[model samples]
Target: MSKFTLRFNTIAAALALSGLFATNLAVAEDIRVISSGGFAQAYKNLASAYEKSSSDKLISGWGPSMGTTTNAIPVRMARGENIDVVIMVGDSLDTLMKEGKLVAGSKVVLANSLIACAVKTGNAKPDISTVEGLKQAFLQARTVAYSDSASGEYIKHQLMKKLGIAEQMQGKAAQIPATPVGEIIAHGEADFGCQQRSELLPVAGIDIVGLLPQEVQLSTPFSAAIVSGSKVQKNAQALLDFLSSEKNAGVIAETGLEPVAAKK
Candidate 1:
């Protein structure tokens, strides 16, 4: 072959190989996520922006931090489901790590939440400005509801006891399963609802009654963790890093969660 022909063929091969590599870099790979409703909107907004900014795609799953139902993150993990990352209540993530379900040292606080109350729209909002007022509101409502999530569990097992009205609410109160308490209230299935502020804000026709009194309210912190043996560890870590950054504070707050102090 002529020298020129040989050189031309070699250059073409190199260019083709480089083009293949570049195409691979531009295509985003899927990263799986399991997040509770408490912080679902924040992660969703961040994930959408992350996809636009780069080639890392997000495949998400929704579930509560703790529950026995199919949508519970812990239940899904225990059943051998595959996921790249988990966003859940902080203490629940700690429990999963202790049980060897998540990678050690992979947990990072994402945001803090307040357990808040809501009532149907166009209705007179209840008075929960004081501990006595909260208890009275609970007692006064004909039907009240809470979720099957961590916040619901807290209100059911702890807050009820604190208010000294647990027994009185037994028949009048309902425990909603894997659904937003705000949803139940909005539909008029329940006259009153209590859940994480983040969960409540997204539902329409529910008038937020504000956070419960400090004396009987819960300040729940949330976190994210890397799932063990995830197929997309590097990408998953990047997503976590973005969610935990201080720059995302405004978006996080818009979802009704308070951003924790950015890590040093």
Candidate 2:
């Protein structure tokens, strides 16, 4: 072949390769995610694994599944922050979908979180194995702390009332906002701390007593959904799939949550 033709073919090949690289770069998106504390630990572990195996990038943020705090996911959505995926309570996700904040049919259950109690690491563990025992534990504690999220709401509105100690707990029990209950207990700000087992596990200087008794247990479903206005819907869906996949069930379970993927 003529040298001119050979040089021209080489140039054409280089252009084609450059175009392919650009397409690949476009396909790998930076997906922004906001995860509630209930699923944060497990999501972090799974996200690390996903990042290692895929070219897509994840930008993570934390907030309560339901709250009016400045950092709350719903409040962030209301402020029109750019987000791609949300990992939060199932009911809260449903509320967002009803409000048209999340894409329809994009919700996926990741795990079930059970309410649990904790105390400072060196403090005596309370007996919460039975309904009455839990009540007594709460009534006896000088000060109690719970999250401002789903588990805290349950403790404040339903569980305490069901235990017939709502009146007694009125002054003693306080809802901790924008912070984990375990942290409160760890700091000795409260004698007893109550929140999702998964949320408690991540905090240091606290000993998780145990899950709430079956009679008064509240099992919250932690779910993930794509934000309605996300520019990277496909990448967001992939992340949700990775989080709820059977392959990640062990990691989810290790974080003190019941993996919904395993149940399926």
Candidate 3:
């Protein structure tokens, strides 16, 4: 071949290779999502669907309790984790936005879940339908377990106070150190366990008692947002979009969470 022709062919091949590389880079950017345990299972279902439908983006690590074993998602952000997106208690996300950890105006309300009690699948499901019924159930249990998360915190302080039984519950009620609340109940370590409805439903060997009555039921709205300095903003936003969709909302509802009143 002529020298000039050889040079032209090499240049053409180099340009082609560069174009392919860029295309792959664009398509392979996966969204990094950190979320609370309540939404993990439902979000995983949606992530699978989204990934199957897209070529330019993927949903990556769905970190349920991403901060670590000890810290909440907000605390994780304060500790300098590079989270592209976070799904957490809505109000907590608001505080993070105010503190400049998350991008302002980027919050998306995803779903809401309420706290409920569960017992081992074969155990008699206690009636906690009314305020008095709840008190009776609490009094009857040999050991009750709740977590350190939002729902657990509320039960420890608010519910016990409402029933005027904080002092009485001091020894009988235990603050659970970690999750799988239902699993704890299943093992008979706790006569009853309480946590967000979604988190409790999928756990093995537990039967969920109905949600707390309206007078005492606690509903927590969960929201999502991208971190202000995330380099993977595009990928993160794609994840947010998928999670906020109506189709995914149905899946969330089926999994025991209520859909958010409005999308962001």
Candidate 4:
């Protein structure tokens, strides 16, 4: 071939590549996400992998699924925060959807989180293998910390009542607001702490004792949904799909949660 023809062909190929790059850049989106502590670790793990493989980007924020705290997902939504996606407790997500805060038909269960107890690192691990043992542990703890979210609500009300220790745990067992229960225990502010296992695992300086006894165990569903009126609905749905995909189940399980298989 002639030298001019070869040069023209190379330039054409370069222009095509440049156009393709620009198209990708144009299609890329920044999906804003707010996740409660229970699913944060798993969402983070899977998000990293998704970002590496896709042109989309994820901007994450943390909060509790149901609380009046300033950073709580519901509070943020009420204040009109610009969030595209929300990962939180399944029941909370349903409530939000019913209230029209989240897009209907967008909810997807990502994992099932079990309530667990923890103590400061190097501290004695208490046996909570039986209903009686769990009651004894709570009774023995001088100061117990639980979350300000769902698990905490259960511990403060139902669990204590069920164990017939509600009166005894009155002032000593308190909900730690907007903070992980594990953090309170790690700081030695509380002798025992209880919260979702996934939330506990992310905090350093704490050793998870074990899950709550089967009879009193609370298996909370952690789920994701797109925020209502989000400008980037398509991108938000893509993120939800990535998070609930079967391929990422192992990652979610590694974070101390039981991954829920995505519905077909």
Q: Give the TM-score comparing model 4 with the true structure, all chains together.
A: 0.89
TM-scores, one per candidate: 0.89, 0.91, 0.84, 0.89
Cα lDDT of model 3 by residue, 1-264, tens digit = 999999999999999999998976645465667778788777777776777766534434433342345456766676787668888888778888899988888898888889889998888888999999888888889899987777887898899999888888889898776556788898889988788998898888889997888899999988889999988777677777777887676788887899874343
- Writing each residue's lDDT as its tens digit, candidate 1 over 127-212 gives 89999989988999999999888888998899999989999999988888887888899889999889999999989998999898
Model 2: residue 185 alpha-carbon error in angstroms: 0.3
Compare candidates 2 and 3 on TM-score and give the better one: 2
* Residue runs of model 3 more than 4 Å from their true location after superposition: 1-26, 56-71, 261-264
Which candidate, 1 or 2, would have the higher TM-score against the true structure?
2
Best by lDDT: 2
Runs of candidate 2 exceeding 4 Å displacement: 1-26
**lDDT digits (tens) for residues 1-264 of candidate 4:** 999999999999999999998976536689899999999988888887877767888998999988899999999999999999999998988999999999989998888989999989998888999999899999999999999998998898899999999999989999999978888998999989899998999899999999999999999999899988998898788888888888888888999999887334
Which candidate model has the greater lDDT, 1 or 4? 4
Error of 4 at 115 (Å): 0.5
- lDDT tens digits, residue span 98-217, model 2: 999999999999899999999999998888998888888998899999999999999889988899988888888999999899999999999898999999998999999988999989
| Clashing pairs for predicted structure model 4, backbone only | none
Candidate 1: stretches off by over 4 Å: 1-27, 262-264
